[model samples]
Target: MSLTTDLAQAKSRANIRAKARAKSGSETTPAGEASPSPRSRRRKHRERIYQWLFLVPAVIYMALFFGYPVVKNIVMSFQDYTTATFFTGEAPWVGLANYAKVLSSSLFSTSLVNTALFTLGSIAGQFVIGLALAIFFQRKFPLNGILRSLLLLPWLLPLIVSSAVWRWILDKDSGALNRFLGGLHIVDTGIPWLTSTSLALIAVVGVNIWIGIPFNLTILYGGLQEIPDELYEAGSLDGATGWKAFRHITWPMLRPVVSVVLVLGVVYTLKVLDIILGLTNGGPANSTQTIATQSYDLSFHEFKFGEGAALGNVLVVISLVFAVLYLRASRRSVDE
Candidate 1:
């Protein structure tokens, strides 16, 4: 009799549990509706809208500042827009005429070759000397931090100021550099640093190298600091200390940074205008004239806006190509 009573109570409890579960389910979610309450949905939607609103200003700024200029330049490249265009409000489309005019000019080849040489020489000198300086600074020394900070003065100063300072130093007559060389009897006379057609480009490239060294040194030094000391320790165990360890470990580790630095150096060197304009003004028979200087001369000096835009577009294309190289290097760096 007692066992029968216990079974009856158990059945009743089971029925109660079923009804409770049904009640709870009905309260929690109605049929076929998985979403939360309307208030919560509205809150989430508001949050999403706020997130988008935060990004709107940045998007708008980029469109106005960066996007508009590039588009305008491209349009100008295809149109015959000059100083008169502002008054007349007419810029007739000329298709590829502007491109042809600039490309067919005699100075195009010279500018292109000068651009190549300038980029190569500046990047090579900056990277090598910067790397050497970075390595040297990695060692324990008195006033190392102060000296490294001071090396950044050239890069921190305005390009015009740096160029002007260099111009004084490189002056043919009575310049400090000439005075030093004469005192040492190195040249026996004041060398024309920025005057000679043969030497102006070289002088400009050297100044650029000086300007770029601090950048390279700072980046490479940071990259070197990221390298693990344990790797060097293990490498030393295998008789890989000085050059061999650097060749095997450091080079492999630093290649990505080197790639980034070189690509950036090339891009920056290619677009260099201020230094050249300030220092040489593409003078001495246009020997120092690069694509950038040429473009500036055409636009501002000669009022050939269309031709200048075309040359500027060429530079943009070259930069875009190098940008691809940079992206590849960055991706490879991340992968490795």
Candidate 2:
């Protein structure tokens, strides 16, 4: 009886000692884990601070450059901002007047139509020819590398230089194209490739396609290279060859890259200004005048900065719409 009583007292004393230790330590700390030292906590906080510091430059750059410009452009579109406003530092708020004028203008419809036709023609021609060239270059042949490198020359040249060269090449009287045609006796007279309103846009589209082909080829070639060769090998074992292989194997693998190329091509083509400006200067009865050129004409030539800003915003909205559509389509594809 005395020994049992002594054991109970010892157990009670052990419980009291454990409770005392618990009261002195962190209540929220896990039973086995020691509380974090102040030095370790400070080190972790400093690491987090360093991580944020790395992002500071990028955030600042974006805010100052991209964010500010977009906001300024939007504000300018709503105000009567022009040369006088630049001098006086005062741009009168004109509400939707600038938008109304831009949207209601007859030139707007013409520019819109031209923009659509130019984008569609340029994208279609660039993608089709580029994909064909990409596929062709996938084969092994002598001088293949040299020829592929040479094909990139058009894309490497400056837009202004390309336009100038094409301008000379398409000249009615002495252009290389006309000269070649004349030598072959294909026509009695030189075709008015640039002077005629009907042919001017076509000529410009051709120039753009020539310039854009290399870009598409390079991207699509990379994509084709990324596709696994084993897939082709396995398909060949299953009797898939030539067009059948391309249809079942090559295309599905290339769709993601194709989507990127098409989206970028459309966006870039929509805002094309320098090429058209240099080629025809949006001339020949304004037949090739797209929204981009019209916006430039409004802002610089006419000094209607507000109207120009409004027109530019319209193009921006169109681009945003296309981007949004692409995102939604991509999401849907992923979901499926």
Candidate 3:
């Protein structure tokens, strides 16, 4: 009985010692509460510095290139400054006169119409041809990779070079296209492809479509490849075939990619200048003039800086509108 009572007393004493140690360990120290470890503090400081350092170059470039020019152009559009006046430091404020002139001009209307037609035609043609080619190439075939690479040749070539080649092929007397067509009795004589207004516009659009096809094809093919084969198999097991399969399975899967391509294609086609410049120079009567070409002619050729700025501003507005439309459409599609 005496031994058991001694053992219980010893156990109680051990528990008290352990509780005292745990309490002391839990107590916070002054130094520990005052500051965090050097490593963690240094890491946080380094992250902030790196964040600003990474953004610095981009901010500087935008201020110099995009911000300054936009401000200067806006200022210039309100001033009536000629070549002489530009150097004389005597530009008169013209308010809305430059804008009024541009809006009232026949050239502006014609160029707007031409630009619209070109943009729409090129987008339609490219989408059709590219989608067709992508569908055709989705299957396993011989020399498929080789053919795909060869198809990109036109797109890879410099725009000026492509324009020059097209010009030669469309030449009245000595062009290869004319010769070939004549041999086939397609035409009675060599037609003036570049000299005719309607034909010139059509030819420029056709060349743009041809050049754009490869890029669109590549993108569409990638999208097609991403679609699971299981979806098609399931579609086939149903009563779906041909167009029904594409409409229900392929199109829904490709909607996002198609939206992106359409937006980009519209923007690119609207801003096309090099091809038209090299091919026709907005001739044979200014029939192929687009906003980009018109801007060039106004600023450099006619020395109307204010008018050119207005035209550029208009183009910017158009692009923004399209971008907004695209975003809304994409959002609605996703919601659906």
Hey, what RMSD does candidate 1 come out at? 15.3
User: For model 1, how does the per-residue alpha-carbon lDDT over 1-336 read when each residue is reduced to its tens digit?
Assistant: 443454455556656767886887779676545667898789868855765565566667678988999999999999998999989989999999999999999999999999989999999999999999999998989999999999999899999999999999999998888999999999887899899999988999999999999999999999999999999999999999999988999989888889989999888989999999999998889889999999999999999999999999999899889999999888777667
Candidate 2: 10-residue stretch with minimal lDDT: 1-10
lDDT of 3 by residue, 114-223 (tens): 99999999999999999999999998999999998899999899999999999999888998889999999999899888888869888889999999999899999999
lDDT measured at residue 166 in model 2 versus the true structure, 0 to 100? 92
Candidate 1's TM-score: 0.85
Please give the CA lDDT of all the candidate structures: 0.90, 0.91, 0.86
TM-scores of the candidates in the order shown: 0.85, 0.85, 0.81
**Cα distance off (Å), candidate 2, residue 67:** 1.1
Better of 2 and 3 by TM-score: 2
Ten residues in a row with the worst lDDT in model 1?
A: 1-10
lDDT of 2 by residue, 127-181 (tens): 9999999999999999999999999999889999999999999999999999999
Deviation (Å) of 203 in candidate 2: 0.8
On lDDT, the stronger of 2 and 3 is: 2
Report each candidate's C-alpha RMSD, comma-separated, in the order given. 15.3, 15.1, 16.4
Rank the candidate models, highest TM-score first: 2, 1, 3
**Model 1 backbone overlap count:** 0
